[model samples]
Target: METCLCPLTRSFRPDFVLIRQHAFGMAENEDFRHLVIGMQYAGLPSVNSLESIYNFCDKPWVFAQMVTIFKTLGGEKFPLIEQTYYPNHREMVGGRLGL
Candidate 1:
């Protein structure tokens, strides 16, 4: 993790960067976010901008944003998303959820 503070660009200077597959729900990836920050500091643009990358962590937030956008394009058969949140393990163990 410490090694990636900044890339040593003596050998290769990338014109652009594409960061992906860093899945969410990972506490360790917080450091990876720092790497992204450093890259942003260097002005190295990416296919997925840093803001979107950060947004990927919160699924409900993303769903809400999508719902907002989908609401704009009115139609009878527009994709209707019924959001159902699952209970945590503790809640499930306590019989909070029947299913």
Candidate 2:
């Protein structure tokens, strides 16, 4: 994502159409909204908010580090994988079993 952004922004001056396409691809999952909200509340600057949040916490930093590494290694080579387990897995299981 970062690699694509660097080149795309350079060529297109951060075109909204292209940015939306890229953003849509990244934000496909429902939980992404949480991350977006968290970042917004973190009070970091817009452009570097992600990096700032990463630097603010160990867990966030680890996540950001993984993403940076993934981006550097090329998103194509290490494509994003959707988790088979849902975030509300335990709740779903409990409801199903009438627990």
Q: Across residues 1-99, which tens digit of lDDT does each residue of candidate 2 receive?
A: 344545443322221111111112234462333454554565434544454433444333345556676778877887654223223678556544210
RMSD of 1: 7.6
lDDT of 1 by residue, 41-99 (tens): 88888898877776766776777787776778754546755665445667546654321
Off by over 4 Å in 2: 1-57, 81-99
Collision count of model 2: 0
Per-candidate TM equals: 0.55, 0.22
Cα error, candidate 2, residue 29 (Å): 32
Best of the candidates, TM-score: 1
